[model samples]
Target chain A: MREQFDIPEGVIYLDGNSLGAPPKHVAERVQEVVKHQWGNRLIRSWSEGWWEAPQRIGDRIGRLIGAAPGQVVVGDSTSVNVYKALMGAVKGTERTEIVCDESTFPTDGYIAQSVGELTGLKVRAARPSSLDLTEDTAVVLLNHVDYRTGALHDMKALTEQAHDVGTQVVWDLCHSAGVYPTQLDEIGVDYAVGCTYKFLNGGPGSPAFIYVPKHKQATFENPLSGWNGHRAPFAMEASYEPDPGIARARVGTPDILSMLALDAALDVWDGVDMKAHWARGMTLTSLFRSYIEQMTSLEVITPNTLPRGHQISVRCENPAGVMAELIARGVIGDHRPPDILRFGIAPLYIGEQEVKRAAEILAEIVN
Target chain B: MREQFDIPEGVIYLDGNSLGAPPKHVAERVQEVVKHQWGNRLIRSWSEGWWEAPQRIGDRIGRLIGAAPGQVVVGDSTSVNVYKALMGAVKGTERTEIVCDESTFPTDGYIAQSVGELTGLKVRAARPSSLDLTEDTAVVLLNHVDYRTGALHDMKALTEQAHDVGTQVVWDLCHSAGVYPTQLDEIGVDYAVGCTYKFLNGGPGSPAFIYVPKHKQATFENPLSGWNGHRAPFAMEASYEPDPGIARARVGTPDILSMLALDAALDVWDGVDMKAHWARGMTLTSLFRSYIEQMTSLEVITPNTLPRGHQISVRCENPAGVMAELIARGVIGDHRPPDILRFGIAPLYIGEQEVKRAAEILAEIVN
Candidate 1:
């Protein structure tokens, strides 16, 4: 699996949680899309395959996230999709409040705040475990895994709690989609949005995905209803009637060049099993954490009681300076503001040896 | 400029109105970005220019649209940007209506309807000329050029009219941005959104641009407020505070691959004057229209009383069949539903000979 990525020589990249490294063949495939499909075939390429790439590639992502075929469609940034999902959740309901995880990725919190303002719902912040769900709660936005702490939240339990209160759940899967086996279908998550550029290795800022299950498809009102989502997009109709399927999640013209790049990138996951892949990720993180605890005085901030995510974060003094020193020595990790250093263990391309070496380098810098 | 694009060997690509021909150098530039920048550098590429790409590429596009630097920021689909611009316009106003052009490109109309629904503003459709200007109108959404017909609207006059009624105006420049010299700064247009993939030749489904002039920047309230628009995006602040300038329009992580391709495509417009470029488009359309009128019984639907846009639309029976037959002969124009056949004369890659050849072929097929 490590042979599948174009990892730079002598560089121990532990930032897959921030931006995954590129797959070895994505560059060649993207070039072919640029030269042959876009350059030569031009507009005819849209009908040829480009028009359906969103749903097609979305199914590829769906396989990993436990969404059945036609349940996911990819396009737009996660922020835009967050807005759509939150807005779509409260459509005909009389609920007047949106409950959001207090510690969420800023974009999700900000987008949820905006949705609350637009729909006249008050947004309240609370821990996922203690959401204080009520019948008046229109929707709850939760991050499957905390971005800063790498603590995995129990999606199934939280969703059931919200459902018990007759409220929908919108999960921000940015940190968990490819890292963890998020069974969106089994959990019956109302809506989910995730970025491909992180654990999926779909280049920088590749478009995000929106999971709109079959049950929610008919009633899903996409607020940013672009022509592409219309029943007959080519008909150029004035009235907006959404497609009666997963494609209602689509908003506007897809970013094709990036989308095709992502389609190619997904080929790397073809024969990989999510459960086994995530198990290997745990092994690698466990090994790395053991070395860090033994060699450094820094405190691991990633909660041990909770199921861990793909990354491990450690609290240390002058963490940005420590990360800069570590990167200078070829150990690539990112630092959150103030005092936390984060390292991600990507099961596909990253292996035991690389994670061990990264921990050793980090221990040297912190000491 | 024709040589700068990889126009297919035997196709008269008149569908630049729908999707522009890919620039030849864009393939190589994107390949390098995928290979060297993303593959080798990985997350390091964010600081190595990826982070600032939306605003940087936006400033280059601003040069063509008569906006200075620090005004236009590019990302998201035109549908998403329409929501931002419209919602940004009616922030502190007490107006209760949003006036949209009845014949707008469907995405603009659909997005306007959604925005009106969310903001509690009633959406009313009217011709740009006959819009009932009133103090109650919050914002007027107008297309600089009609998508179905190639009629250009008067921005200066309509903007002045909307201003007199204390209503802000949002212009949709999908059909006119790169072909006509849209003086957004000079006209003091309240807000505007445009597609990059059309006359800009920014590849298929390239991200769209949003223009928020200096004055509007202070008062513009981006409803889809993602953290990327935050004053300190990297700070990961919980409360949303928009950046003081055009960056406030940015909502989320940019689509870097498509955006870089657009940045490379904009190089084709380096020394070309928009005024002279639009003059040539008019000349080409005139020559094509004259040939079609002389040889075929098609009714040119683009009004002669109004200023023409880059394309020429002709109404004929079974227009889709006629367009298919025309495409079969390698003349690639598109049909808009029941009647209209649209041909776009992109001055950069299209010229006198290709336009003439396309017209002669269309005449033969129609007759």
Candidate 2:
């Protein structure tokens, strides 16, 4: 698995939570797409395979996230998809309020705020546990794992709460998607959006995917109704008629070059067991966290619980400076503002030795 | 310039207006980006160059489109950008109507309808020339070149008319950009959105760009305000405070691989004169249209007058069949509904010989 990635020599990269390391074959796949498909085949390539890539690659992502076929489609940035899910969720309902996790990745909260203004719904921010999921709460946007603290949330429990109050839930899976298995279908979640670049390792800023289950497809009123979502897109009709399936959530032309790269990246998950991989992630994080606690005086912010996410964060003095010093010594991690350092544990390529090496470097920097 | 592209040996691809051919060097550039920048550099790639790519590549695209630096930023799909331009242009106004070109590419009309529904404004579809620009019109969305008919519109006159009514104007340059020069800055165009894949020679479905001029930057209110548009995006602030420049038009993480591919593709424009290239386009279109008329009974729909776009549409019986036969004979052109067969003459890589040869093949297919 380590040989599958092209991690640089002596560079212990712990920033997979920000941007994942690329698979070695992605370079070749991208070249083939650029030269053979796009360059040689040209427009005919769209019909050849490019036209349905959003749904095709989306289903591949669906396999990892516990979604069956025809429920997810990929394109657009996470911010745009967040806007789509929130706006599409509340289209026909009489709900007057949108609740969002106060600690969500800032983009989700920002888009929810804009959707609130557009739909004339009041926006409220609260912790995931304390969300006041009344009948008037149109939707609640939650991050599966906190970006800054790497804190995992109870998706099944919170979703049941929202459903009990007759409200909807939209999950931001940016930090959680490929790290562990999520039962999106079993829970019957209303909408889910996640980035492919993080733990999914789909290169930088690859397009995000949105899940609109089969039951919800018929009435999903996409606000950004581009022609790609139109039933007969090639007919080029003046009026907008959305496709009857999950593709109705699609907006605009699929970013082919980026999308196919993600398709290639998903090949890594074909034979790996997500549950076992998640257990390995726990082992690596526990090893790294225990080393830090014993060797340094930093306060580990990530909770020491049974079901934590793939990363660990610690509060320290002058985190930016400490991160730079660590990076200077070939330990690559990132610092959030104010004073926290985050280290992502990607189980596919990262292992026990790399974790101990990174912890040793961190201990050296602090001492 | 034709040698700079990897056009297949026998295929006379006349669909560059739909999807441009890839440049010869884009394959190598994309490989380097995917392998070295993303694979080895990891998260450090953002600060190295990815953080500013939207604006950096935007300036390069600006040179070809007659926009000065700092007025253009690139990301997202053209449909998404159209929504942004329309919504951002209509904010802080008392006008109650948005007039869109009646025959726009369907996505533009669809997005305008969605924006109309969201903003509580009346969306009226009218021809570019016959638009009744009244004081109540907030903005008029016009296509610089008609996608189906290849008829070019008067940007200067229509923009003046809209200004006369104290209304803003948003231009969809999907068909016109990179084929000719658009005086967006000189015309004081309010806002513009255009795709990069066509004549700009970005890869298929590369991210589109939006131009918000310096004067309008302060008041531009982006409806899909995401964290990327935040004043301090890295600060991870909860509130959305738009960057006080063209970047306010950006949403979400920059699609790095696709955008950098576009950046590499723009290198083809380095030594080319856009005005001279547009003249050559007129020449090629004229030759193709004349040859078709001389040898076949096809009724050409593109005007025979000056200032036409790069495409020439002809009405033929069984257009789908005719286009298929033409493609089978190595002459690649596309067809629209009922009877329109569209041939796009890209001046950058296409020339007199390919146009004449394509016309000869078309004559054989029809006769």
Candidate 3:
């Protein structure tokens, strides 16, 4: 698994949460797609393979997230997927409010606001721990892991509470999907969306995936209603009739080149145990946190009492300048503006020694 | 310029109008982007080059389409762009109808129907030649070339007619952009959108481009309001304040791999003249039509009295079988159901010899 990625020599990359390192086979795979499928086959490739890319690649992603075969399909960006899932959840409900949190990813909040404006619903933002899940709430948007603090939420517990109050839930898995084990179906989650560029190791701007439960497929109407979602996309129909299954979530022509890269990237996860992978991530994050706290006075924001996702965050003065110096010293972690410096522990390529060295370098910079 | 593409040997590819052959350099360019920019540079590539891709590549395309600098930006699919442009046009208008034609591409009509349903407007479909442009028409959606018939419309005349009746126009330039010299700015077109896979020779399912005139940028709002279009996208603002320029039309993380291919593909047009390219297209299309007419009894649906686009369509019995036979004989053209055989004449890689051979093959199959 460690040999599956192409991380550069002499650089410790702890930003897999931002952009995953490319899989080792991606360069050769992309060349074949461009030179053979596109160059030789031309338009015939649509029927040959390109047309089925979104759903086929999506099913592979489904396996990692515990979704059924027909429950997840990949297309569009995560922002667009959030809008689709939010709209699909609230379409015919009598409820008048969309509930999200201030700690959610900013794009998710922005999408909620835009969808609320379009559907004439009130968008209410509350603290994550203090959300009042009520009957009037049409949808609750929750992040599986907070992007800035790496704080993991209790997804099953929150979902059960929302269900008790008769409200649907839409989860943003951008920070949790590939590295964390998500039992979406077993947990009875209604809708989930995640980007592939992060821990999934898809290249920059690869298409995002959305998960809808089996029962909700028939009623899911993606508001972006492009032709790809039509019942007979090639039939040249004048009216729009959405496809019946997860394919209905598709909004436009598949970006075949990027989709194919993601398909190849999924090969690295062939037979690994996700539970074991999650254990490794926890061990690595816990080790990094303790090493840093013992060496420096920086405030670690990640909560240690609860199990979290694959990253650790710290607050230091002049965080941006500190991160620049760390990168110059070959320790590559990213800084979110204002005060936070974040490091991701990708279980696939990152190991214990790399985490130890990264912590040592961070202490040297801050002190 | 024909030497620049990687069309297969012994195959006369007349389907560039459907999917353009990959430029010879695209394979190398895609590998560099995946391996170095994405794999080596990691997250830094977003700020280094990916941030400006949509606008920078758009300017290159603008040079070919006669659009001024900062007038075009590329992202999303053609279907998505159509939805964005149509929604942006009718946002504040008092009129309540979207006028299109029955002969327009089916996706454009479907998008119009969807937008109308969302915005409470009636989508009226009339014949292209007899479109009733009145005060009730909020926006007119017109295709520059009929997808099935290869019939080119008089853009300047139709635009002036729409403006005379006080309605704005949105043009679908999918079939006419790279091969035809479109004066979008000169014609005062309000909005335009097109795909890059055809005459632009971007790879399969590459991101599409949208053009908004300089004067219309401030007021335009893409209904798919993703954070990428925010005024300061990295600011992570919760409220949606659109970017003040053509960037407002963008709506998500761009597919950098495909976008970079399109960026390199646009380099093929650096020193070429579009007017000269359009002239060559007319010559090849006219020759193919004459050769087919002299040898076969198929009914040519393309009109000779009017200047048409980069292809010719012929009506024959069992078009699917005819196209199969033609492809078996190494002359590749696509079939649009019911009864049409369509052959594309891309001036970049297609020339007189390929056109003559394709016509002879079609004649032999249909005679």
Candidate 4:
């Protein structure tokens, strides 16, 4: 159905993992918000709809991610949301260890280090293979999928292990949100944060979302409580009394222009089946792996038989150069440091032929 | 002249202090970015223009605030920046006190409480008359201008006293930046945070500015250390090493759309002297004060002295009702609790005629 949408010609977009390509209707949405809501409605839009974008959109994202209504609020960058989630997760807990993987994204590690350094708590972030879950762990912070390696974490098992030790777990869902199925509610994860750009296709710099399970929503303390999160924002209270809903996580007035893009972008996901999305991912990734392995002496860092997210990572001896070559050949993907080339498969706007051709292009380039 | 710029008509645009009216050029700027920088350039925009917005516009804002060029960086909302500044201020210090005012905006107090409740530090906040500026204080956060009452703090004395006690001072410039003149450098204030939407007239949710003086630049730590803050954001370093200058304060890629509005809005300030801005503020506040005093038995909450910020606050019997009435009558301002009406005066755009007519409208309704 998204064939009706327009993506630029000759551009093979694989960098959705970094910043999603613009949604079809984002331009119209931006124009409307700038001309009407801001130009005409002015400040009254706060009362009209300007104020509730965070909660309204949060609930919409919650529907996709297995969260109930009123348990997710969108605002800030994903990293900031990570900071707030970790800070709130650690609050009032006697546990001293904030467990995470050392291979985590720098922001997550930085957040863990920041929380630990400022709070004097110990952040014991080891490789998952070497991790020891203990009662002293306050929380576990992990990406649902590794950004560079594209390795998936078993949410249910890790969450259960953390919970069995009386430790809370906060999940970063940046790469897993739209292309894969998640059982956040079923897994009983404590908190989650993610950006919309990767798979959700919220355009660049779109606001990020935070999920606090209904059980944790009422108790979460958003460390960055700007006036927007006030119980009665217009009441102008001096003390911070959070709104009882997921809206409590909002830190400031959202960028409505960027925000409306997310809403418009989500419209594309209305009828698509997610399994079909994952199948497309696996098919493309498998083609990519098999083709590159046969065509050239390339090392695929993405695991062969492990559960994976919607991306493939291969190690070329000159990944950056090969990536530039791939881009020149009209196949767009990104290269991480140390010879890792990453490609994300998103089916909403991606077609099977594109994947086949992309693999063929990789094969030719490698040869 | 700013008068050449057109604001939409017939709306008594009072909430410039909440979310500033858009600069006339912002729509076109947004159009340019949406169609060109993003739709066309796509990811290349990051390496070209998008990545530099945080420090680039920060320096623009620093020019207005009398900060040196390398001392300010823009990113995060005021609250997140508050957490970063406050957290960074207290690390490795012997001081145990984090001082604030109870009447400070919840974001300010909330962050101080966060530092204490998250970290093991002790927090000391005071009401107006009882605040303690003591030796044990690691940092003192005071609103340069009170959000509710339009009250101003004595930056020189406070910063000097804090320095005398080996403590740092963090100024929340939300109510002060682009309103009138305040010599933060002249006052030796160690660090400051200010939003863009208020008097600076960036659009809603503009990235806030953080000022770390040139002297303190070497020791500053960005507690919110996302990839953007790393010394080589593109290098993708394994360990975090912050950029040497104000770039150390950047945490995330800024919203370029919002950053552009602030960039253009600073044009509203060029060549217009701040001395004239301050003098006009006094005149406007005095006129509005006289008008409010002439008719109503309402109390004036803003201090009537040389040191206060440029806004005027008049107490009403029922603030919400009065604010509604004022809005209906087209006199734009904000109402704070129990019963306080506050108006911010930006002399570059607001003049004696606007203030006098605004007072007459208030007098006609309140009487």
Candidate 3 vs candidate 4: which has greater DockQ? 3
Minimum summed lDDT over a 10-residue window in model 4 chain B is located at B1-10
Report the C-alpha lDDT of model 4 over B211-249, residue by residue, as the tens digit.
988888789987887777888877776567888888888
What's the number of clashes in each of the models?
0, 0, 0, 0
Candidate structures ordered by TM-score, highest first: 2, 1, 3, 4
User: Which residue pairs come into collision in candidate 4?
Assistant: none
In terms of lDDT, the best-performing candidate is 2
A75-194 per-residue lDDT for model 3 (tens digits): 888988998899899988899999997788788888888778777899999777988978899999999999999988888999998999999999999999887788999999999999
Candidate 2 structure quality by residue, lDDT tens digits, B1-367: 8999989999999999999998899999999999889987889989999989999999988888889999999999999999999988777678899999998999999999999988889999999879999999999999999988899998999999999989999999999989878889999999999999998889999999999999999998888898889899989888899999888888999889999999999999998888998998999899898999998988999999878899999998899998989889998889998689999999878888999999898888889
Using DockQ as the measure, the top candidate is: 2
Q: After aligning candidate 4 to the native by TM-score, how far in Å is the CA of A14 from where it should be?
A: 1.3
lDDT by residue for model 1 (A132-198), tens: 9999999999999999889999999999999998999999899997888889999999999999999
- Against the true structure, what is each candidate's TM-score? 0.98, 0.99, 0.98, 0.93
Chain A, candidate 3, TM-score of 0.98
Answer with 1 or 4, whichever has the higher DockQ.
Answer: 1
Docking class of 3: medium
Please give the lDDT score at residue A252 for candidate 3.
71
Q: Write the per-residue lDDT of candidate 1 for residues B1-367, one digit (tens) a residue.
A: 8888898889999999989988899999999999899988888899999989999999998998999999999999999999899888877679899999999999999998888877788999999879998999999999999988899999999999999989999999999988888899999998999999998989889999999999879988898898889999999988888899889999989989999999999998999999998988888888888888888888998876536798999998898898889899998888897789999888888888998888889878877
Instruction: In model 1, state the lDDT of residue B230.
Output: 94
User: Can you list each candidate's DockQ?
Assistant: 0.87, 0.88, 0.74, 0.49
Fnat of each prediction, in sequence:
0.89, 0.87, 0.70, 0.42
Candidate 1 residue spans exceeding 4 A from truth: none
**Ordering by lDDT:** 2, 1, 3, 4
